[model samples]
Target: MTEKQVIYLDFKASKILLDGDFNAKLSDCGLAKLGPTNGNSHVTTSIIGTYGYVAPEYVATGDLYVKSDVYSFGVCCLNY
Candidate 1:
C-alpha cells in the first residue's frame, strides 16, 4: 500500500480475512488516506469507529496512535 495511509478504523472479521494462500488481507478500505507514513499517531476530536474496536486511550485522549491499532487488532484476533 504505497503512498497510502490505511488505518483500520473498522476492523472486523469480514474486513480482515485469510486469502487463498491463508494470508491475511484487509478489505473495504472505507477511510484510506492517499499518502505515506510520516507520524506515529493520528489526531481526531470527535470520536468515530466501532464500539469495541476503537481503543480506550484514543477515546479518552483522542490520540490515534499505532498502539491503538494494536489493541483493535487484538480485539479482532480474540473475537476471530
Candidate 2:
C-alpha cells in the first residue's frame, strides 16, 4: 500500500491460473496489493485464511509481516 502497513494475503490456488499464453493470472480474485512496503509490518487477531498456506510465524503468533504474503505465494507456487 501507499502507507506503511503489512498485508496478509490468502492466496488460494483455485483463484490462480495460467492462461494459454502461460501468463500468471489472478483469475477472479481481483488484483492483489503489489508494491514496495519500505520494510513495514502489521499484526492481526485470529486466523481467517488457509492454515498451512500461511507462514509458521503467523500461525504461532498473530504478527503478520510483508514477507508473510511472500511465504504464502511461495507455498502456492510450490504446490503449483
Candidate 3:
C-alpha cells in the first residue's frame, strides 16, 4: 500500500525468504535496498557496504550467503 510497506515486502522476499537468514544483520540503515532518502530523488544503485564488515566471498563475488555473514562475524570477533 505504502512505499515503506512495499519496500519491506521486497526486503522480506529478497533478504529473508530467499536468503533464509532473517536475523542476518547489516551495518547499513536496516535497508536491504539502496536508494535515496526522504524527499531525495537521487536513487543510488550501487550496493556499497562497509569495508571490513563485508564478507570475503561476498566481496570477491556478488553472491551473498548466510555463510558470508558468518565469516564477517568471525572477522568481527577477531577484530575485538
- Measured by TM-score, the strongest candidate is 1
Give the local distance difference test score of model 3.
0.42
Rank by lDDT (best first):
1, 2, 3
Best by lDDT: 1
lDDT by residue (tens digit), candidate 3, 1-80: 53541121012112322236556533324544433446654332334456666655555655444344456455556764
lDDT of each: 0.68, 0.65, 0.42
10 residues in a row with least lDDT, candidate 3: 5-14
Candidates 1 and 2 compared by lDDT, better number: 1
Over 1-80, each residue of candidate 2 has an lDDT whose tens digit, in order, gives 25644353577687678999998776543323343344545555565567777778878886666677788788878886
Q: Model 1: runs farther than 4 Å from truth?
A: 1-6, 32-42
Q: What's the lDDT of the predicted structure labeled candidate 2?
A: 0.65
Please tell me which model should have the higher TM-score, number 2 or number 3. Answer: 2
User: In model 2, what is the error at residue 8, expressed in angstroms?
Assistant: 4.6
**lDDT (10s digit) by residue, model 1, range 1-80:** 54555556666776877879999988877754332246635645456778898889878986565445678778878985
